[model samples]
Target: MTKLYCLPHAGGTPAGYRTWIKALAPEIEVVPLQHPRPSDDEPLSLQEAAESVVEQCETDEDFAFFGHSLGAVIAFEAVRALSGPPRRLFVCGSAVPPVEASRGRDLRSLPDREFLQEVARLGGLPPEIHADAELRQEFLPGLRADYTLAETYEYHEGPPIPCPVSAFRGLSDGHVDKDGLRRWGEFTTADVTAREVPGDHFPLRTSATFLHRAIRKDLAA
Candidate 1:
């Protein structure tokens, strides 16, 4: 793919894609999608975020997509809303976007320290920062907002995206296994391929080379 749009994990900013961009072949251009935090001026639902992205995506480019964690689902929804589908769509570290209610601890509503501690346990925060009582406090709001976004997300009923789909996962991530990743095939009529890379959930955030490799395989196909 000549142009790829990248989306980030929960609590992630566009800067998270830098290493992923560099790790890719020099011929490919990376465009990171900057999802603004929900504001009173522009409160974003999943569809709203998708709409925002669709408006920015020009019809002429041979665009492909790669999104991790919450970004994966957002990208999925966004592709469905696009007038022209991308060449390929890659999703990692998530299940097929959840439409119904999910069962879990209500992390968003938990007390700050308790919530931060829980996110740490789930590998959301660095252990050192989670341990540093004062330092962890600084990350609370963004982290909470991200988790709340994830927890409350509901898929809209729509026609599936037409692009080829590829799913990737950290080998040991307890959040979603390889099978869950495979289920993404249900959302697309075109080819859906799944693979396992060596790492946990958070590594995909810092380790872009591996993610680049996974995405390149699809481009080569």
Candidate 2:
């Protein structure tokens, strides 16, 4: 079986990819990974997160990586850190390319209410959490930490990973336009394929079928 490691979006957990395990069954083993959460005393950095992800993988074996939003950058960094590269890299919903990338805005300093509102605007926050104050409180810290990593990301031009890159963007995603999606091509020497799925920034919710079908087709190839 080919392992398909999945990294989640900001404030997202392994559970986010739970359904993928079943969806891409027997042939592709979906291994959803979690980045470290920030503690009050210490915050998690993107490099640390990438190193942590690298440690979790079986570098000796063949595998592919799929990442969404914030996870996309982390996965790209992890791929760079790997001694052995993945078969392919699927980056979804990320507008910023890895070269000199830094998602604009200081979301880390926004007031709790405003911060949540901003993330919600980007379709990063869940409606259930937004409606529940307690859930919001519980979720805020990690979200902020992840956002910090994203907002502070500074990509130095390094050798592009020796793997084909597949970029996916949601048609209705206000954050990512066609030109931004095309920028991913700069990071890879191999072929780069870009597909626009139907939805807003959150493809899993609005267009899982299209997303899965595209992934299945790539994996099959």
Candidate 3:
């Protein structure tokens, strides 16, 4: 049985995949990577965080990666660092070859209110969370830190990976343009495919059946 390592987007907790895991096949062991923060422990640079994931996956039999947004970029880099190849790599809601905005930058410098506004503009955070003052304060710092790490990530130019790559995006995703999504093909030697689902960036929540069928088909191939 192959292991499926799941990585969450910026400001996303491991809990994000709880439902998806239950929906996946039992043969696929799901391991969600936890990003280190000041509250969680010592903070890790994006590269360090990716290295940690590769380290933990070292003992697995066979593996695959599924990452969303910021996590997609990290999963790409982690596979590059691996001692061996994974069975497949699925990157959703993220661009490949690393876009400038996807690289780590210090977004924490922004005023909290402005930061939340910027995130809302990006289309991931819920409007309700933004409306509640207490919830906004509680979630803002972690979101900023995650965005900073993502903005600062630097992509290394290298030979294409030997594994199959699947890039997924929503038809209405405001963040990932088609050209950016197509760039993902350049990273793989195996067949590369791109899919557009029916929702915004977080299509898995609304189109889980479609996502699952597509992934299951790819994994079987």
Candidate 4:
């Protein structure tokens, strides 16, 4: 049986995928990488985080990769750095080709109010969190730190990946444009399929059944 290595989005934790894991085929082992927050006692650079996942991946069995947003880019690079290739790659709600301009910047440098507003606009956080000043105050720092890590990542042109790649996008995702998603095809020598689900950027949270079915069908193929 192949292992499924799951990666979380910016400011997201392994717990976010618990429901989705239950819906997946039981034969597949699910491992969600828990990346540490920059201020959470132990901080890891993106490269360090990726290397850790590579080291922890089940080496004896076939493995597949799935990621969303910032995790998507991390998963992609991690596979490339692996000793060998994964069975397949699935990415959701992220721009392909990676964003070069945002690399190396500290997102915490932005005004807290402006940053939270942007987060709300991106549809990642619940409106009720922002509505509660106390909750917002508690969560915004971690969110900003995650953004800083994501925004600071740099992408270097390298050989196109050889494995099959599948991309998932949301029809209502304001954060990713269609052309940006379509460009994912350029990274793979094998088949690359782009699919659109009916939700915002957080389709896994809003439409888990639809997303799971799509993933099951793709992995089966």
Candidate 5:
């Protein structure tokens, strides 16, 4: 059976991909990866998170990576650092490498009020989490850390990997468009395909079954 490593979005845990284990079983084994929270003095960075994933991975196995949003960028960086590249890469609901902030403002630097506004526009985040002050306080730090990692990333130029890239986007996601999706082609020497899945920014949640079916098709191909 093939191994499929699933990475979650920022402020997300490995549990987010728990359903995938059973869904893609028999033919594929799903391994969900999560980032460790750093100490207060040690801020998070893209490289740190990626390196952590690389350490946790079983590099000897035949594996592929599936990541959403911030997880996509982390997966990409990890792939670049890996001694053996994955058989395939699935990047969902994210822009091409060297991801920029939604607007000119740095999301990590924005005030809580303004930063959340930008986040709300992106969707995926539950509204109730923001409505409750205690929850907001608990969640914002990790969310900001994720934003910092993504927003501060600088893509170093390198040869495209040999594996195929299957870029999945949400039909209603305003952040990424067809052009952004197509741009993923530049990072792969092998075939790169763009697919429009259901829902807005969080298709993995809104259309789990459909997304898994699509992934199964790609894996089969």
Candidate 6:
């Protein structure tokens, strides 16, 4: 059986990918990375986070990567960090090569109310949760760390990996555009395929069945 390692978006949990396993082909096993919450009481650099994900992979098997948002960046970096090639790489709901954001906005440093307001503006957050003080307090610190990790990532250009690159973006996603999404081709010598799914920034959760079929075709090809 081939393992498909799935990475989650910011503030995301394993439950998102766990849902996909039911839709995935039985031969393709789904392995969701264990993302650290901010409350883990330990801070990890972006590279360390990638390494943590890599350290968990089982050896002696064919495997591939499927990451969304922050997970996408980690999976991409982790693949480059490894000695062997994965069967394929699929980055969903993120820029292909990943563009850099402006330095020093520091969303993580804002006060709880202000920081959450910023998170809300980005979408993916529900209004009801925003209104709940207890829930907001619990979700804020961890989510802020995720946003900081992603925003602070410095993308250093190196030789592309040895597997095919398939990028899946959200048609309505405001975070990334098609040209940026298509740039993933430049990272790999293998043929790259870029296409849009139906939602924004989280199609992996919203469109798991569609993604399962798409992943199945990619693996079969």
Estimate, for each residue in 137-187, the C-alpha lDDT of model 4 and write its tens digit: 887776777776676566778888878888888889876777777788889
Off by over 4 Å in 1: 39-42, 99-105, 127-135, 205-207
Badly placed stretches (over 4 Å) of model 2 are 98-100
Instruction: Give one clash count per candidate, in the order shown.
Output: 0, 0, 9, 1, 0, 0
Lowest summed lDDT window (length 10), candidate 1: 97-106
Query: CA shift at 68, candidate 1, in angstroms?
Result: 0.7
| Candidate 1 residue lDDT tens string, 1-221 | 57888888877777777765777758677888865445445555766776777776665888888888878887887898887889899888888886312644578888887887677778677555667877666666666666766776766667777989988888878778888988888889798999888778865754557667767767877
Best by lDDT: 2
Candidate 3, residue 189: how far the Cα is off, in Å = 1.5
- Reference-based lDDT, residue 32, model 2: 96
Output the TM-score of candidate 5.
0.91
Better of 1 and 2 by TM-score: 2
For candidate 3, report its TM-score.
0.89
Q: Tens digits of per-residue lDDT for model 2 on 46-105?
A: 878898999999878769999998899899999988888898899998875554265567
What are the TM-scores, per candidate, against the unseen true structure? Answer: 0.88, 0.93, 0.89, 0.88, 0.91, 0.90
Runs in model 6 with CA error above 4 Å?
37-41, 101-105, 124-128, 131-133
Top candidate, metric TM-score: 2
Candidate 1 accuracy as lDDT: 0.75
In model 5, the worst 10-residue window by lDDT is 98-107
